[model samples]
Target: MGVSDTNYQIVYRGHHLEYFHPGGWVFFQRPKEAGGGFWLGRTYDFVFMIELPRPVSLREGILYLQQLKYESAS
Candidate 1:
């Protein structure tokens, strides 16, 4: 297994879900495929959390996360 995954238990990978930070942040590792993301397949650059300024509904929060992921990747 990868070093970053040594002590980490990943529930999913493809959907930008990897590990969780203590501060309620989730990380999504960029894939090694072409045009992956900001991390560009580098395991270390896999920070995928964005803190929203205001409180949002659970559905909105998920949308924000997805937006952040795409923004960061582009």
Candidate 2:
């Protein structure tokens, strides 16, 4: 499956969030909203989680991860 079709597991506040596809080669802010935290990860078998001043949207995070997968695949 392509990066766009990959599924992700997102946990927020001890709750499970829906899986979303992060685009390729994109930067994603973290936490969900503003003033939460930031996270970074590769589509491969590794993910780097970071804390941000604000919670970013899930779309961005997912897209960024997908990009990583694409890059590694290349």
Candidate 3:
């Protein structure tokens, strides 16, 4: 899990959905073994009650969170 002034991020080392940030956004990140990558849109018409993913690794998840902040800032 990660927290910053702009947003919060949680990385699941395992496969399971146990948390979410209401009114926020949800994204899916494919594992590296399965072509790992992720892209998050700037805005959404609706809120996502669940944000879950089985990232390739914890590093990938941290990278995703970093991008999340950068992308959303723009």
Among the numbered candidates, top lDDT falls to 3
Give the least accurate 10-residue stretch of model 1, judged by summed lDDT.
35-44
- Return whichever of 2 and 3 wins on TM-score: 2
State which candidate, 2 or 3, has the greater lDDT: 3
| Top of the candidates by TM-score | 2
lDDT digits (tens) for residues 1-74 of candidate 1 = 12263332222236544444443433233345643322211123434334443434444545655676789999
Better candidate by lDDT, 1 or 2 = 2
- By summed lDDT, the worst window of 10 consecutive residues in model 3 runs over 39-48
Query: Model 3 over residues 1-74: C-alpha lDDT tens digits?
Result: 43344444433334532455554433344456776554232223444433333333445545666886789999
- Give per-residue CA lDDT, model 2, range 1-74, as digits (tens): 12343444544543433343443122233344556543443232234334333345666666666676699999
Give Cα distance to truth, residue 13, candidate 2, Å: 1.8
Error of 3 at 70 (Å): 11
Evaluated against the true structure, the overall lDDT of model 3 is 0.45
TM-score of each: 0.34, 0.40, 0.34
Q: RMSD to the native, candidate 1? A: 13.4
Name the runs in model 1 displaced over 4 angstroms: 1-50
Q: What is the Cα-based lDDT of residue 59 in candidate 3?
A: 54
